[model samples]
Target: MDTVIRMNRRQILTGLASGSVVAFAPGCVENPTLGRSQLILVSEEQIAQLSAQAWQQSLQRERVSRDPALNAQLQRVGRRIAQASGLGYDWEFVVFDSDQENAWVLPGGKVAFYRGIMETMENDDQVATVMGHEAAHLAGRHAAERASQQQAAGIGLGLAAVALDAGDVENTAQWAAILGAGVTFGVLLPYSRRHELEADRFGVDYMVRAGYDPREALDFWTSKAAQRTGRPSVPEFASTHPSDETRIAALREYLVARNYI
Candidate 1:
């Protein structure tokens, strides 16, 4: 009698490693109906788990803003944009009491906005642009994409060794704090340049669909880059985001070529 354990696709390609497994490099998922994206590997269930945990920490650990009307405004704006998304996932909006100008959307329509960014917009359109960008990220499954990349990285590392054992990566701490995602935005993620650009482009259109002018997205990014003033932001190499200047330029090129302005 032979006891043969069948390895899943991920285990097969990844061969064997220490504490890990990987699947074959899959092709990009394309949604022709909506021209959006869908998950090809990592399940939405996993995203929900990650999102739930991260959101709990955000509410408990992060400072929350107290302005009543501001929170209301965020909800209103987020709703309008989310409606345009046509995504049927669970949605949420949260305002954090912070001075840094940042906003992000997690998978499953879990959205958050920092009050600091509220100060940057001159009108609803600008804010809408930002919202659209964040929305684009979720709609395109950017978080899952990042997660997939991280899986690949971990699998690659595992495959480098012998058959995977759970203890191989037990003690190694990552060093992507400067900009990479081991701890921050791309936690356990390693994205390529292509994904970021796609997100940016898709964001512009989402803004348009949400009835906001897409051109301002370009302006918004340019203004942000200009305001950097040599301040240390996370480096692009390790960060999931592109450089400020690069992002601004890409937005410009995208807007001009598409006549979205």
Candidate 2:
């Protein structure tokens, strides 16, 4: 529901249903959640369901390596970051048996890392940088925000996005369920670019609080972006984060200001 229409400036919308067409506002459409149909269509439960389904599908299709060593390292980093956010622990870190270089942290402290990305991290600090960024997305509640924005923009829940499965997803994820191996690799891995950058910002702060060198975070992302640049990440609208350069530049500025560099 719209509290007010503020395309440029905030204006009070009195009542359109009252038929009192003589109010102060001439060029405004009055929208209210109390009486009007909820234009913000999706519920928190729906978003959660959708994301959870998608994530669930994702984990099952991929080969998950239940490697104790890798899981511990990832959890260590993820927890360090999450703990700083004042969110309690019950963190689950799973390493996927895949070549794709990506990682994700679901809401409610679920974290995952691909074998390829973990191998690329030269040290725990570097891995911590990546983990911090991913955790930031959940810590900052970026996914829920993205879903809200998507609903507001009239983009319905993604076809393969997180929603309750009418039937059943085989294995991997209980949420963020990607349906097929092909789609998981090609489609679901990326997030909206805005979500990506916001994660970066959140990640930077987490890495610092976790006692990792924040300056290296940029290089960390740069390395990942460079690897996938020629392939071109999914288009912006479909993606959850910004392109690599934009993310790098923003972080560069913020980190420099924060003296994390």
Candidate 3:
């Protein structure tokens, strides 16, 4: 009975994988902002619904700061970056009352920044640096792209598992786990790094267009790099984000190429 169940599972996975690939192939669409094609299997309406749910959950889960000053700063910086993006999202910015040095943007222009990060900004240009980066993520449609990639990878993995099972392979579970890790470190992580780099480059462009000095982006990232000294380092291949050194260098190179430095 167990063997029959296993065989059925393998057959189901195999069929799903084959059908998914054919169905999702046409999802490749050109993104004018990034000047590249992106796999966007999920529709904008679907992403927006998910984003709204996530935003509401975040508001319920995290203590939102009521500080008028912090809220004003975020709104000021966020609005400018949103306008500069030209994506026409109904933008909303909120300050989470956390001491974490982090900020993120959801699809449909829901932006959140931690008070810790906001307090560290020395000027509005520094604020713009972070705002522009979050806005760039929205402009790049990274959330949707990432979802599409994961869906595709799951299909590929399903097919691989079926092949292993059909071959009567030993240690099939171990092989499947290894393949999963390979997909993470090889495909997903690399694309995430690429997304970060893209955001950095275009974020600087948005900053410039919004009348903020792009040089501050250099200083901001360099400071972030300095703060990482003496910390345990994850290899660039295994991490979703580029190393601080790599990001700083890339930003500098881009700024110089665009004559922003």
Candidate 4:
């Protein structure tokens, strides 16, 4: 986690009132994989607990595929990335019987790959592209960081409410509007972009370490980019992710800089 703790208006006001100064959350830690510090209000225990519940829920909700080949491929590729990451997570990968081009990994190395995404992958290398990226998200501790940031933002909004109350501003409608804008622009959008890019860069590193060609990563994204040709796209500033072009360009630069090409 990031080292310095910067309190928002709510913490500042509370400290002044109570004559005490401290961080809103005390669980900041440095992550070796990300090469930076993070504000992790949510602990590993909490994430594991929640992930266990979520994994169970997913098992009940989604249709799990029992194809032997699919299961074998997921286990093989996922294990390679897991080994490269050097994290001793009890990894389990499943293929869901759905047409959604999506895959996600929970904190405890619980992964779900939709049949749609699997069908789109041309080779095991492409599967490794998705696997490495999702694994990098876990290694980077992006989930806990996002949760902490949102908690801080919520505290800021609470403080703003207090300030409004002190000033006798009774317009509840106006307060809601301001809070919505603060959360959308301040907390959610920016961090999402950063997380995606970080995952992309570190994902390629994992791919190379796992003995997968980095070029396949670029190819996978290029194909996905083509798929988005006729669809609408949110502007980069307001979006939760970098545009495909931006993401692909960054991947190319990383591959070149690291000599992974």
Candidate 5:
């Protein structure tokens, strides 16, 4: 009985790895905001449902700050950017009471900013810098595209695993793990960096449209780069985000081209 169960599991894995698993045909849809076509395997409704769950989880997991000043500023900047985005995603912004210099956005316009990052901003224009960037992620439909890419990569990795198993390769588990890391660092991370750069460019555009000083975006990113001067740097290729210098340089070029500076 045990041997039968083991064989059945192996067969199932092998079948899946051999591309026998059924899935929707991948679709490339035009994203008007980004001016590009994106591979979107999942529906917007599905991504929104997931985003709502994630938003709830985040509220439950993090210590939500009730600081009136912080909340007010976040709302002020967030609304302008949201309006500029024109995505109409039922946008919600919450400030987490953390010292980590981090912020993130979920699909459907859910935005979270940490108190630490908020404190770093010297003025509303600086706040607008980050706000517009988060808004651009929604405008770009990045979450759905990222999920689709991962889904595709998973199937490819499964095939690699099955091939190794069929060949009776030694340390198949180790090889599979290595292959998974390769997909992450090589494929996914690079795409993430591209997304970051795209956001930076479009975020500045949103800032301008929302009546914020676009040059402040350059100042904000430059200060961020300086703050990281002493920290250990991650290689651009391996990191999920571009280096601060890379971001600042790109932002400067865009601002120049647009004559915003």
Candidate 6:
């Protein structure tokens, strides 16, 4: 039994390493800007198509801002960053008439910002900070890569269970819980934190190239961190994003490393 268990473990590890679990070269492609290879299961055309559907749905459900001043400001800042992004995406920036301090970007450069976040920004540099970050997610191919990784993980877990069964190992509730927690905290959450940091670093670079002050990025995040102190707390490992402290610290380190100040 001991020898059989050892053999099964070896087979599982060998399968994982030999591309039986993850075909490293298939869906993986090198992103020149991020200088990394990403697993992109979904094609750009599919993402764009889905984005268009989402954009249309949002337009129907959300009240778009007609504030002339806000519209003009968003357009001005968005154009500068879009030009600097070098991603060649057809960027569309819209301001939503809401008080939620939030912003998001869809694939193919569809971006929406709430009036709440806009009102909080002291300057266009702050806007550029967010825009650059969202754009970096796109240029970094994060959405597709995330989907692919999750899919692969699901498949791998299923295979792992099968392998364990073949080796006469029980897939008990405790084992399931342990494995689930390990995947969530050790792999998925950490990957998300890394994505956030990568976006932050690339965002700062985009801000600088777009003639926005990189210092404003730091200031903006610091202000956000202060705001979060009064809000409900979320554990870093349980959340898909890193804590504000972690993000801010990483941003500062990256800024200093790149001499962005």
TM per candidate: 0.71, 0.65, 0.80, 0.79, 0.81, 0.78
In angstroms, how far off is 149's CA in candidate 5? 0.7
Compute the lDDT for candidate 4. 0.69
By summed lDDT, which 10 consecutive residues of candidate 4 come out lowest? 162-171
| Model 3 lDDT per residue over 53-163, tens place | 556666777789999999998888888989999979888888989777777677788787778778878888998998888788778888778766766887332212111
* Reference-based lDDT, each prediction: 0.58, 0.55, 0.70, 0.69, 0.70, 0.68
RMSD of 4: 10.7
Task: Show pairs that collide, candidate 3.
Answer: none
4 against 5, candidate with superior lDDT: 5
Candidate that beats the other on TM-score, 4 or 5, i.e. the better one: 5
Q: Which stretches of candidate 3 lie over 4 Å from their true place?
A: 1-26, 155-180
lDDT (tens digit, per residue) of candidate 1 on 63-83: 788889778878887888888
Residues 1-261, candidate 4: write the lDDT tens digits. 000022244543443444223334547788888888888775555445545555666777778998888888988999999899887899988898877677777677887877778888888899999888888888888766765666677743222211111101011123233346667666665776787789889988888899998899999999988987887765666655677888899999999999887
For candidate 5, the lDDT comes to 0.70
For all candidates, the clash counts are 14, 34, 0, 6, 0, 0
Q: Give the per-residue Cα lDDT of candidate 6 at 10.
A: 49
Clashes of 6: 0
Off by over 4 Å in 6: 1-25, 155-186
Backbone clash pairs for candidate 4 read 1-29, 1-30, 1-37, 1-38, 2-37, 2-38
Show where candidate 5 strays beyond 4 Å.
1-25, 155-179
What 10-residue stretch in candidate 6 is worst by lDDT? Answer: 162-171
Clashing pairs in model 6, backbone N/Cα/C closer than 3 A: none
